[model samples]
Target: MSTGTIITGLRHRFRQLNEKPLRDDLIFYFAIIAVASVLFMALPLLTGEAAETDGMHRAWFIVAGTLIVLVQGLITGAVALLAVSLVEHFFLLFVDVHREFEKTMKSAVYALAPLILFSRAVLLGVSFAGLLLLAWFCLSTYFGVWIFHEKSKDRAVFVALATDAILAFYLHRWTVGPWLAL
Candidate 1:
């Protein structure tokens, strides 16, 4: 999608039930991961720890390190996306729901925008944009359940909290956390 579309997606949280569903194309999804991974790699430079890590000061080392971080972050992010989707779907199973897994995947997909677009600012100790982005992620994920599946607000909130907990406790370390620490 274009930059305008992405910005609009962020503003709308990418979960408008009145509109068409999220595109089922894997390429579009992975493209988000790729861009996020690139942005993630750049975040560590703010602290200079990325260059300091394993003597990455040299130009060649920087190039190689960037490629490695990009690949690792991409893989980890994809796996997290799948895992979170499954978890969210599993939670929804308690209700008399009959939605496809793609619905949950769509919810999880929108949550990434907050992290990928605004997380660096949070890590950098900037303004409150990060918190808003995070709220956007969680709130969108909650609303997405209502739009895509049952209208169980409680279950939706639980799914959102669970998703955020997983990110904070587990997936964060594998994906963007390392970059922030580097």
Candidate 2:
């Protein structure tokens, strides 16, 4: 199919998901973020960072990590809204959803505006590593959705998550392990 068809289909799926309250979306986003958070926490341990040894520090770490994941979840929620809008507009050709492509794209760009905050955070901060990972993962997930709009969402998400896992594992072993002497 053409690129236009793919975009339209994604927009349709997005609208379908968004026909509910924000809370439902939040729940889904948070669950994904929490799983990702656990993975993030585990990474430090794999490198012998001792996050598990200090109970007090680990408690504080979890609190801070949870807040960061929550924020990342909020960002994903916003991106979902935009993707839904775009899918509706683009795919409306197949199953029209009362909106123009230009209008939808404009709205999507605005909806994705907050993602820039994440880039800024990555550039300026020395802390909140787990949050950074969550932000990057969310961004990657959305981009994967857009790129693989022709596939079932299950396949697309699986493709994206698998790619990320492999890349992260390799990078951890090749780059981080040597630095940390693990």
By lDDT, the best candidate is: 1
Cα deviation at 18, candidate 1, in Å, is 7.9
Most TM-score-accurate candidate? 1
Task: Give the alpha carbon lDDT tens digit for every residue of 7-70 in model 2.
Answer: 6775666556535544564455455555555555445656777455477887787768767866
Give the lDDT of residue 106 in candidate 2: 32
TM-score for every candidate vs. truth?
A: 0.65, 0.32
Q: After superposition, how far is residue 8 of candidate 1 from its true place, in Å?
A: 14
lDDT of 1 by residue, 48-147 (tens): 8664544445767767767997889778778877887887777777665687887778777766655665656666656555456656777777777766
Cα miss at 131, model 2 (Å)?
17
